[model samples]
Target: MTLFGGLAGVAGAAAAVRGTSSRRISPYDLLLMTAGTHKLARLMSKDAITSPLRMPFTRYRETGGPGEVMEDVRSEGSLRHAIGELVSCPFCLAVWAATAFSIGFLFAPRFTRVAASALTAIAGADYLQLLYAQLQQSAEGTS
Candidate 1:
């Protein structure tokens, strides 16, 4: 994790040195990035479709909530296990997701904002879907 953070820091520093200095973050952009980071981290860490990417370092445990999957880290090697822990955890991967979006903002703000907006919309939609499902369940119970 330290290595990963160090590499991300180096990339950000290099980008800043190349004249893409840090820009003031707007509240809108901050919200978008937060939602984007959450969704992207969940997508990478828990989504069933992304399990293949984590397969090398993790073992499938069971189906997780909704479209997510539960995975256990392979305990063979330290580095591989560490990576497994990161890949299998949304909270852990959120740091990487946030850092990547930050770097993307430095390199290409417009594209980054667009991508973040899309992710935010998806996150919102996911919440709405869950709410809708809950309402349906409630209605059924009442009926």
Candidate 2:
């Protein structure tokens, strides 16, 4: 089978499993889920330090500034490889993260918010740190 077919099968299976699970996903929760997915996905798939974890499964491509582009994965013609691709892709992993968040939000709203808050807060902090460095560099260049 083609790689795209395998990827589709993995995603489909995940969705089917999620569908079978009991949960309530409201419009507002969907918004929170989207936000959470964005934050968590960034950390998991794009962070510089996460390279080691994905290195075995992915190949380093061009630099993505703080992170790097990963390719040549997910096509090893095996389920393990497909999972690796899923784990290495922010957009792909976001769906899984969002699904987990949906279940967590439904079953453990308090815990879910606390964890999401931590990650969201860290994401905010990361931007602020980058901004601070940029401003510092500008000042240094000006002087």
Q: Pick the candidate with the highest lDDT.
A: 1
User: Model 1, range 64-141, lDDT digits (tens) per residue?
Assistant: 999999999999999899899999999999998998888888888899999999999999999999999999999999
TM-score of candidate 2 versus the correct structure, residues matched by position = 0.67
lDDT values for all models: 0.92, 0.71
Ten-residue stretch with the least lDDT total in model 1:
16-25
RMSD of each: 1.3, 5.6
Tens digit of lDDT per residue, candidate 2, span 1-143? Answer: 36646755665576567663455566765665677788788777866677777766777676675554545464565876876777678888787687568657755777887777777677678778889999999999999
Give the clashing pairs for model 1.
Answer: none
